[model samples]
Target: MACRRLGGVPWLFLILAWLPALCAAQTRAPYIPASPDVVLQQVPPTTDPRVRRFEQLRLDLQRHPHDAKRAVTLAQAYVDYARSTGDARFLGRAMAVIDPWMRRPLPPIPVALVHATVQQSRHFFKASRQELTTILAREPNNAQAWLTLATVAMVQGDMDEANRACVKLANTGGDFMGMICTASLRMLTGRAPQAYALLGLVEDPGPKAPPEIRAWIEGLMADTAMRLDRAALAEQHFKQALQWTPGDNFLLADYADFLLDEQRPRDVLALLQGDSASDTSFLRQVYAETALGLPQAKADAAAMAARFAAMDARGSHVFQREQAGFALHVQHDAPRALALAQQNWTVQRAPQDVRIYLEAALAADQPAAAQPALDFVQRTHLSDPSIDRLVARLRSDAMAQAAPRAKP
Candidate 1:
């Protein structure tokens, strides 16, 4: 997904999906089944042409491992699978597939791009940015390279850099891809309504539109709708996107979060059933179970705690935001949660990052610690009712406490 943001059309040359945070659970020690029939993993058989093509590519790459073209193609496929499934194990595989070319001082352009993509997928933003910079310096009009660079900048909270990259993308003659990227930027920077309206044009690009494009647009629309507090519309868009890509872990996790906010934990349970292999999905499931007061919530929380411990042991900071959430919501350790959230906020400034930081600040009764999130909301004018409520309460509490202290 890092390599592909929104599907490119013609001149744009395939732009695809947003890169999601990788699940750190993939770093756990390998589990060996006592018997082959024990079924450690299960995927329903599929006759899907893409899956068949991927299988063929896998075989071809196996036979010709040194073929850079086949290797890049297969690695891209693996990255796509990692994004859709929320299973980062595929990302490691992708990196390994391209390792041969990575050793080169100047790998082939295609290999360089895919390598950058895998690095971005793994949250190595600086490395990915450097790789993309090198590629763009060599080929300025490369649409894919430009779009990927924009994604990296956006995720890193460098909106100006992202806009510059998007401008470069538009100059490369891919109006549609550039438009989508720009709309995404606007949605994140206080123009959700306008971005939502702009996306309507691509909402129904007829049957000719690729599933990936349609699904990506719908997901974006759904998020914008959520920001605007149009809950029903958001749910509809989320459902439509899921119909397009049923196994998309990003969609499932997002929709599940929406359901939880709507106080429909039962719906989350139904939505995320059998999809907790990834940390994101599993965390959502834990939230749902907590909401329902299910008996299994305790065990699940402990299991999740173990996973976070493993991640910390590996010195992996990519999942700090998620770990903060687990600490606050599941462990109810407000102080620790606030600490983690503050640390994560130093890395990225996404809306969710702000939300968790504010929530943890509130829970820990540390109103002053919430100043960064407060400043972000004021600067961005981000419109989210839930976040607004938290901000309002935090401000009120801070005022009340300050008043008492002043009187004393």
Candidate 2:
């Protein structure tokens, strides 16, 4: 589920490392523990054991704030929660938990990993890469460090570095993780068919693999299929992923985009209903509402505007792509959307990024401004039906504009 807009790899292995025992234990009725306000989603005591463990960990860390080991453990748990919930605030909480070791010349491996995770979540790729490099220099056989480095490199569009890190992972880590790492990069680099076929070779680990990992692989397959114009296969893979990890924000957002592209706004609404806690989900809901011309669209657009304004006021520019889409589709400000999309392109060149840039450029009647996107398509040899249609339309419009006026 590590789509371009979502940022970074899925980090399923990190979550797998901390999964609690699944056995049902005999105990009294569950009660809420007095924990910090950092918990974003409230899990009733009687339900998910993961939530119970998270609550206990929070309370334990609060009691022994000076204990480095407990702090690292809690921070790691918070990072896992952030990944599962898509709540960026949990990343901030993870940073707070590890604040004590932030300035150390060489923090513990656990703390360093948490720090890098938080940095990457916040879009600080360079900082995260630096930390991971330092960790790997010290522990050359660190599988997690290699995987993280590959993820950071992929996000930054440095495929060469990502390939190198994947090779390192394959040498140190098992083939399963390494294959996933390499296949994801291949999918982005115009080898969708090969990536999909290679990924199909991954043997099902059954209980050995976490559900999240399986869901992530299925999601990637769905994306590859979509790029290949295999709509039926893509939808099937998406369905399989949702079955594995129901209500995952990343999966929900990605499927909503697919529905939007298919002109199924109602399905998008149904999928994202009552799921607006994360910014990604909220953006998708806004898009769906706008497409349906729902009464809530106005309010949702205004709310998103205000949220972006607040982020701008705080000097946070990590959401330029989402903001640009809102501007183009919701606010109807083509120029502003083009500007934001251009700014976003300078940071990430994923296919979605190119699409938005092309969209804004076309909407604003600035075909020349879309050269970067067209160049990207040519350079990467990316093939997507939607992008192909857009390119054709852009050419048609340019020709229509350039036609001579014979009779004045």
Candidate 3:
């Protein structure tokens, strides 16, 4: 999930899979630069209140560059903007805004939170968790700290720690956050139906809930419903989420994926029109074009490849999952896809991650290579019809290969 800025305050919600870790220890490395030449779409001047407020904050930060409070505020706003727009440049911009305190051993809590948010965005999971831990040790009742810790733990597949952090968050009057956090973990642990119902309880079609929170909950419900193979329910939740927060890149990408899976490539094309700034969105467009055998598929594929190459040149492997999927499905490089998927599995074990690993392994004709994902599925009790079918096919293929050739 992406962070959101509301009423000049920034709040984070664990939306989807976990972020990656740049390293176990923090370093003052140069920021990974995104491609400057890639232009997705141009936006005209906006009169939106939120945009106006963010601009004011930017002006304030620019005027008071040395002011820690202003810097953190602007950085948080940037982080929120990055989450909303799926623009990598915003994340780098956030890091730049907080560079003054990057190496500080004891920055203020707000500054530290901003630093951790930047690190988390860059996939430095261990460093982000450490920053959260340090903050919690000093201010034990910090709701944001607890929420961030829970998010980091969930991403790392440390459910026990995540659940404990959720408990702490709930104790700090974050009942709604706690419910969503724990429910998300439950869904991953094969309690999809229960998770869906629990989220419904939190979002009972009431006007009392914040639109942002409702949108996030509906998105999660949509995901869980999809896992349960309730296509209609999933579509309903997806549409409802969009109604609440229109033009959300994450929602659009998720819906595009659902459309792609349903073989409605044209629907995906229409859904993601003019939304290519984000790597994920562009990747989905590539998938749709490839599926429909459109000429633009080649150009889109080349553009994505160049983007990934830029990430590589900067030594940023934070997008292993997306890269692996691209390699496997579009590039048709099964071995490379398997390698990337394996690397990705070490960081996140979400169902999407597992599916990629399994798909890559199968395509590579390396059933043994898929054991880790299969084991994860068994251990977590994760159930997806597509994943199960793939597992069964792999098993049957293995059996056939091992069977004796009597008439040879």
Give the TM-scores of the predictions, in the order they appear: 0.87, 0.83, 0.85
Candidate 2 on 55-100: residue-level lDDT in tens? 8988998898888899888878777767767766666677767776
The TM-score between candidate 2 and the true structure equals 0.83
Least accurate stretch of 10 residues (summed lDDT) in model 2? 1-10
What tens-digit string does per-residue lDDT give for candidate 3 at 150-257? 877877777788889989998984677778877888888888888887787787646777777788889999989988998888999999998998877778888888
Candidate 3 TM-score over all chains jointly? 0.85
Worst 10 residues of 1 by lDDT: 10-19
> Cα miss at 283, model 3 (Å)?
0.9
Each prediction's RMSD to truth: 7.1, 9.7, 7.4
Query: Considering every candidate listed, which one attains the maximal TM-score?
Result: 1
- List clashing residue pairs in candidate 3: 1-15, 1-16
Q: Looking at candidate 3, what is the lDDT of residue 251?
A: 83
lDDT of 3 at 235: 90
